[model samples]
Target: MTSLTDLSKLDDILALDLPAPDAGAIEAARARQNDLTKPPGSLGRLEDLAAFMAGWQGTDRPTIDRAQALVFAGNHGVCAQGVNPFPQAVTALMVANFEAGGAAINQLARTAGADMTVVPLDLDQPTADFTTGPAMTGAECLDAFLKGAQAVDSTANIVILGEMGIGNSTVSAALAHAICGGTAEDWVGRGTGSDEDGRARKADVVARGVEQHGHLSPLEILAALGGREQAAICGAVVAARLARIPVLLDGYICTAAVAPLHGANPAFLDHCLIGHQSAEPGHARLCGAMEKQPILHLGMALGEGTGAALALGVLRGALACHNDMATFAEAGIG
Candidate 1:
């Protein structure tokens, strides 16, 4: 089947319409967070939490009734450098597994009690599911980027983005370097277990790809070096923001995928909730460029929302504390 490929058409799709967060609502949520059970500032991230929910639902009491995890899987051309152990073909294989509900991400989404959608984006593959469709053109990439936000298919206010591509870190590094205006040496990392030699080789490949295609626009950079997973996650970021849902970003490849969207629309940040910082050197640089403070910093290199999954509990706890915790006045402790 033909996938979404027109950049402009994708743009139309990504131009999703949604409600904006109410300034009054967010301010009220912020106040509630400050007055939560523990002493003020006791729940560091919880502070960010209450506010995030407020902004997400446009209510002082934001409820995470529904959450989604979008796992985008694809292959990378630059993986030929042996930066990753898995072959490029593994991307298509994993996409099939994701469709079959047999991948790590699938299991984690279940564990997290969130709905999961797998889009077999036409990467080097031939076909995929309807929920997540074909490879994106410049416009298609834009569409894919917007898919996450649109996937909610409702007024839900929480979402998490993940990836399942093989050799995607290579693509991530290339995309990062291109958009961040940094050298490959500054953004390449060992993805899915790359050795030193592999890291060096990956960097060299990205440097060359950058020199060859770096001058292109950010979207073009994504289309050129971008994998199917990157495209879909980008779409997810767009959809999440447009819908006023907070997106919990995953590790290197996943986070890198959102770079173009964030650059294209600064307002996107309003709906983002970073899961954690990874040991991946390039990810730190990307995070820096985004000016985000990750929720966890466990030096995690695993992708597929493993970090996000591990960190989801923290968000939940923060939410619980923000909403259920007894105020100091209620406890009469102070």
Candidate 2:
């Protein structure tokens, strides 16, 4: 794992100004949104979803267009509380599945012409090939999030973030409570299909974690439960914002992972889209706090970017229509 302390090296990169999305292009896309095949205002929020993506990417051609899914995998210290049904080993095992291209995220990334980048964060026993364990410390987490941001900038112009870990929900709830200032009961949820007993345990664990770490700042909260994957993903989002690359976020854990950075950089919200409303209790609160509209409401609790992967399809279709549709003048129908 890369020591979180090395982040000081990236101070220059983090300070660089990012290019802005074109407002003129966004205005044009908004005009085009009303001109789609459907009646005016008929497609509901999706019309807005597509137009915003197009405008932000500066292309009526906005397509989740070159979508990529980066799965941040790690293990949490809180899982010992019986919060997760799967063993901690599953984080490493499934990462192997992700690398082998057999996981759902792999299939979706393939379908969307999106690359799947597997980032292994600091965990007890990390499988090889994931990014070095995240830099430790809140400063480290911030620096690592910036570094992850730089990695995503290298390839995908637009991206998605997913996570894999046995007890990430526990960490996520704690992070949510810390950053958003809510109770553990408000943020905790069943992760990896926990039973009633497991859910109770998950909530209880998060409550304890919150109370223990509640005094810390956002970065401190991350250092406490910010698994390697969570920290890297947070850094990646910072990098994405710095690069101004649009990011589609998966369920609550992945979204919550970036909280510290979000607090540091509120502009981070302008560069992201929340892909789904997770069944997790705290997800809605987080989304509301971010003011992002989740396109899919599948009650999903699966963290492997399955929800984001699915939502990207709808976003892609919206882009296609915006860029390819023949206007009345072009078709000579008027």
Candidate 3:
């Protein structure tokens, strides 16, 4: 919360009580909205989500003008399991693209006026192929969380979480099944354009992981089933909530990463906004588990925080409308 330096243990970080949204600010925002010239509730969920942002900041005027995207990049060893179409090195290549401002997320974030930062993690060699063995050691998973938590910068009040790693969806489905309660078939999906045969194989891989290692503690489950970037995204969610920043959850892999943390602390969901529902099957399950509705769908499955980055523009518009709409008294209409 405090610049993420001098961090405590991972459990200690998650155990800390996050700052609560200000009820008084929320009430005030709602009151002002009633006086606006537009019909009550006409603006609908856009109005609602904006109010949540106001309460999240405990302010009469909430703005996401300075939103930032936290994109975690890493490689998964299970990529060798034939889960993805691209080679795993594309993870590093995409990171370079992000750095070079060449990826879709870069253009989307720029278009939405949000800054982007990439956090890199190394677990490719250490993490076992969960289809055959554990994805990571418990200590490594804890360390990944610590690093992810530490990735938060002081510049932005709203953070959008995204990830890059070949075969991450396989890990995501595995973690979703292990944590959210579902069959591997229910959780697996076509990532990066996998064919029917590929989807079936992915389901089998996830099922094998769950069968061999299931019902561990949330952290252990993460280490056993999730990738390094996924672990970091989980920690980043906790840190964002502690800092009272509205976290924008990206597609399947990103949302899957947050499930464990939300499982540990229900209050953490207060600060999260499902950026959008990813096209991936497991994304819907994650949203169902969280009781969240995706603000925008658009059939997006690209997972560089692209959906979340684009949604920042919508949030900006929502806040602008909330703050700038004329009241009946001001407009002399009532």
Q: What do the candidate models score in CA lDDT, each in turn?
A: 0.71, 0.71, 0.83
Could you tell me the lDDT of residue 204 within candidate 1? 85
Error (Å) of candidate 1 at residue 137 is 4.4
Among the numbered candidates, top lDDT falls to: 3
Q: Estimate each model's TM-score.
A: 0.86, 0.86, 0.95
Any runs in candidate 2 off by more than 4 Å, and if so which? 1-19, 35-38, 63-65, 125-136, 139-143
Candidate 3 structure quality by residue, lDDT tens digits, 1-334: 4534445444555546678899988888888777888999988987887779889888878876577788998778777788889988788888888899899998898898888888878734536788777888877887888788888764577998899888888988988888888789999888988999999999999898898888677767888888889989988887787778888888888888877776676677778888888989779878988888888898999999999987887888888888999999899996
79-145 per-residue lDDT for model 1 (tens digits):
5455677766777777777788887777777887778887666666522221122223565555555
Looking at candidate 1, the ten consecutive residues that score lowest on lDDT are 126-135
Judging by lDDT, tell me the better candidate of 1 and 3: 3
lDDT of 2 by residue, 1-334 (tens): 1233344643333444556677877777778866655567676676777667765667665655466788877776555556778788888889889999999888877886777888776556532211122224545555546546555744566788898887778778777877888667788776777787877777777766666666765666666656677777876765676556778889898889877657655665677888889888889999888777788999887788888888888777776777777766666664
